[model samples]
Target: MNDETSGKASIRRELLASRALLTSRDVEDAAAALAASALELPELAGARTVAAYVSVGREPGTRALLDTLRARGVRVLLPVLLPDNDLDWAAYAGPEHLAPAGRGLREPDGPRLGPAAVLDADAVLLPGLAVDGRGMRLGRGGGSYDRVLARLAAAGRHPALVVLLYGNEVVARVPEEPHDHPVDAVVTPAGTRRFG
Candidate 1:
């Protein structure tokens, strides 16, 4: 494997290993802080709709950010894994519909919508194992987000792509494959920083 892919592999391993030592609450706290910082960005102001992930594995929580966005009248959409490994979406009207989904991820319930609907979001908060300054993202061996996001980008209808990570998760560079997608920004507990 090339340096980029190797770097991403190392980061993913580190994150997965670290998750064993972290409580759910700890991830939630860090996620809340990171999302708050992202929301503070001027480019993020007044967004009508946002798409967030149901962080599973070592990814951080987006619950706090969802609540805050709802308070501001911003609609939120969460991913639902489709039978074909494509991502479907649904509105997170409130916490009432949320339940634990596969892989220990909690997502909003309701009907599953198409990828086009998710692409309509003003911003998309991505769940990644690690991210590089170039906006390349490393996910949990699934290409769902990468494929969906890449399609959106190719169509020029993509929302701003932001990866949520712990501060330590940021690396000098990440491994890139022809199919990997690049995020627009990375948000950590420290703050939101633009990537590619």
Candidate 2:
């Protein structure tokens, strides 16, 4: 790995280790707060459709926000992980519609809408370990969302890219690569930060 790649790996490990220390209660409280904070963003409030994902493990929870969006008559799209690590989307009906998947993920059990479906979203809630001051996000290095971002760009669709994270996950900087795209905003338990 190059310096940028190794640096990202180190930072990811440290952030994940901190997340592992969170108690179940801590995760729950953060989830509620995250939803509240994220809901207040203009990007979400005005969005007709949102592309999102279900949180697994200690990652900052998105369930509450996803449900609220669906409740608001907003069409919520959840991801289905393809074997190649690219994501396919499906409409999120409710909690009952999510089924267990590999890597401890919970994916929507509805019909696959194919990967390009994300282009129809007005906003996308991304899962990440951390985001930097520059709005660059540090994902799990899976490259799935990277593909999603690329697809959106290729189609000239510029949805509001947002990341839901804990307050501490917003850092001064993160290792960035050429293919890495900056997010429009990040919602933490504390509040939301927007970038240009």
Write down the lDDT of every candidate, Cα atoms only.
0.78, 0.95
lDDT of 2 by residue, 64-89 (tens): 99899999999999999999999999
- Name the 10 consecutive residues with the lowest summed lDDT in model 2: 187-196
What tens-digit string does per-residue lDDT give for candidate 1 at 39-76? 79654576788888766654676767777788788888
Error of 2 at 103 (Å): 0.4
TM-score of 1: 0.88
Per-candidate Cα RMSD to the true structure, in Å, reads 2.2, 0.6
Q: Per-prediction count of colliding residue pairs? A: 2, 0
C-alpha lDDT (0 to 100) for residue 97 of candidate 2:
90
Q: Candidate 2 at residue 37, lDDT? A: 92
